[model samples]
Every structure is written in C-alpha cells, then in structure tokens.
Target: MLKMLLLFLIGAAVSIDLIAGQACQPRSANPGRACKKACTHDAQCRGRLKTCQCDNVCGMSCFNPNLACNDPGPFPNGQISPERGYGQVIRYTCNVGYNLRFGNNRTCQSNKQWSGVQPRCDREYWHFFIILFYMGEDL
Candidate 1:
C-alpha cells in the first residue's frame, strides 16, 4: 500500500506542468489566478510561456509575452489590436485605388508569434473597362 501510494504521488506531480498542482491556462481564459506557473528557466515552460523565468526563481516569470511584426507598407493601412501583447489580432485595409491581396486578419498565437500571412495592398486592375472601350472603338 505504501509503495503504491508513493508511486501515485510521484506520477501525479510529474504529469502536471504547473507548480503546486494548480491548473495552468491562458491569462485571458483564467482570471485572478495565475493560469501559468512562474518559471526560472525556459525548459520548464512551453508555448507563450516557454521562456518563463522570474529572477531565477524557477517559477515566477512571464516577462516577454508580447509579439511584434513588420509594417505592411504605405498608402494602404492596417492595425493590430492590443499590438504589444500576446494573442493580438491584426486587421488590414486599402485606399480607393488598392485591393487587399492577402488575408485581412491575423492572430498572435500562444507561441508568442503571429499566425497568418501579412496583408499587402495590391493595385486594382481595370481590365474590364479597357476591354469595353476597345470593343466600342472597333464597333
């Protein structure tokens, strides 16, 4: 009985990634309590919390949680919501003479990285109008 109990306890501890057997979830999903364990090193955590470390405490850090991306360009405009943090979402738009050539929205993933292609402002082609004008000239 004693040996069985000890084995169970050890297994339980090892299976959980958080400290004190507490649940570790995203900050947005779990409020008030620390959904993640504080860490003193990178190996102890994964995903957005991978580089977790708080003053070498082994568990207490989430320092660099935000993610950044390069600018899309000029004339066309776009914006990233909560731009400086993890789980951010970006939306893009174009001016009167431009069209969006890529996905309009992207999300910052749990790995502290952005997901989806960066949007581009492509110049619109008025080929239909040109074709119609040529046809009229021929007529």
Candidate 2:
C-alpha cells in the first residue's frame, strides 16, 4: 500500500509538471508574470512582444454586472451562459415573483466593460411598495 501511494504521488506530480509545461511553453512563469525574470539569461526571454507578459492572457474578460437577485439570462426566460468574455452579449431577466427594473441586453465591449446601464431585478412585492411610497409622498 505504501509503495502504491508513493507511486501515485510521483505520477501526479509528473503529470502536473507536464501539463504546466505545455500550458506555459513560452516560459515557466505564468502569463501574469509579465516583465518578471523569466530566465537566468535575459536573451532567453527577449524579442517576444513589447512588454512580453503584459497580462495578455488567452481570453478577454468582462466585468459581469450585478444581477440584483435576478437570474441572468439571454432572454426573458432563457438561461444565462456560464462563459463571458469580450464581445459576448448578456441579457438578464428577473426570476419568478420579480420584475426587471431596468436595463437591456448588453455587450461586453472591447474595453472589457459591459455596455448599457446595469440591470436590476426587483421583487414584485418590493416594487409595489416602492411605487406606493412614492405616490403617497406626492399626494
């Protein structure tokens, strides 16, 4: 049992190393380690891109907006995509017993910001209360 466990551990370590090597072939350091020491000799890490590391990860990122207790979806009752990135479009809808307060389908812009006003999901009961409170004040 001890020998088997040791073998398994060794195999896991080797597998992880192999995977890491392949994933980060440019240098052992992660892509986030931009401008850091990638090699003992500077020349080994030279001549890639301007500002080699520069946080240029494989994919674009978007600032996912707050859903305000609403279920984010692509349509009024559709499901939300698990993945988000640059140029990805997102639409949101309130869950049952709730209403969409504001906002519309928005796109993840190239600047990594979501386009359009942030949306809110307000519970139906609370929304009624809000309207009543405003009406009462006006009266």
Candidate 3:
C-alpha cells in the first residue's frame, strides 16, 4: 500500500508540472497583442492589431488620409520607404451653389495632428432657379 501511494503522488506531481508548463507557454495568436511569428505579407497581419507579418516587414498602424501626418513609417529593407511622412493639411472647397456648413478653415496643431473633420457643403436656396434653368437646357 505504501509503495502504491508513493507512485500515485509522483504521478500527480508530474502531471501538475506538465500542466503548469503548458500554462506558462506563449500563445500562438491573440487579438490585441503582437504576432508570435514573423510575417511576410499583409495577409498574415490581418487581425485587429496589425503586426509584422513577414520576417522583415514592419507592422501596420492606424492611417487617415484627411490628417496631415498619418504615415505608417518604413518597412523592411527593399520592402518599404521611410522617406515619406504624413500630411497635416486637407483642403475643402464648396461647389458653386453650396456654402460650407462647417468652418471654412482648419489647422493642424502640434498635439492635434489629426486633420479637421470635413465640412459639409450646404446647397443655397437662391441657386435653385439657376440650377433648374441649366437643367432645362439639356432637355
């Protein structure tokens, strides 16, 4: 009975150690975390937090065209160029009969690097007659 009990305890300890080792192991993939392996293409970095997919490629980050400086930085050698930076200004002009609904001008500040929201062009009521007359010419 004593020998049998000792063998059972040893087996239990080994099993617990194995479980603990597995628990400490790194995960293969996580939504918000970085990639576990190097990727070679964008497809490999498709999850929510884009990571370096290829062996030497850089990861993707948030990018907005309207903002002045939204560059994604450089990629691996011969993979991407780092010379480019993000633009800070975006220009918007209203149509002939439409007036800008938001402020006409916006500026990119030091901390506020994001581009201003696009202003909507509101149609002018006075231009309705002119537009109708122009449409009549096509008929």
Please name the candidate that would achieve the greatest lDDT relative to the true structure: 1
lDDT of 1 by residue, 1-139 (tens): 9999998877554333344344333223323223345554567666763555321212244445544544433434434334534545667677666778767776554334456666777766786688788988954
* Estimated TM-score for each candidate: 0.41, 0.33, 0.27
Question: Which residue pairs come into collision in candidate 1?
Answer: 25-35, 38-59, 38-60, 39-59, 39-60, 40-58
| Stretches of candidate 1 exceeding 4 Å from the true structure | 1-82, 127-139
Give the range where candidate 2 is weakest over 10 consecutive residues by summed lDDT.
52-61
lDDT values of the candidates? 0.51, 0.43, 0.39
Residues 1-139, candidate 3: write the lDDT tens digits: 9999999877543322131232122223442333234333345545554432111011222223222344432222212122222333444556566666655444342222433454666667877788888988955
Total backbone clashes of model 1? 6
**Residue 108 accuracy (lDDT) in model 2:** 52
What's the best-to-worst order under lDDT? 1, 2, 3
lDDT of 2 by residue, 101-133 (tens): 566466654335455666766556877798889
lDDT of 3: 0.39
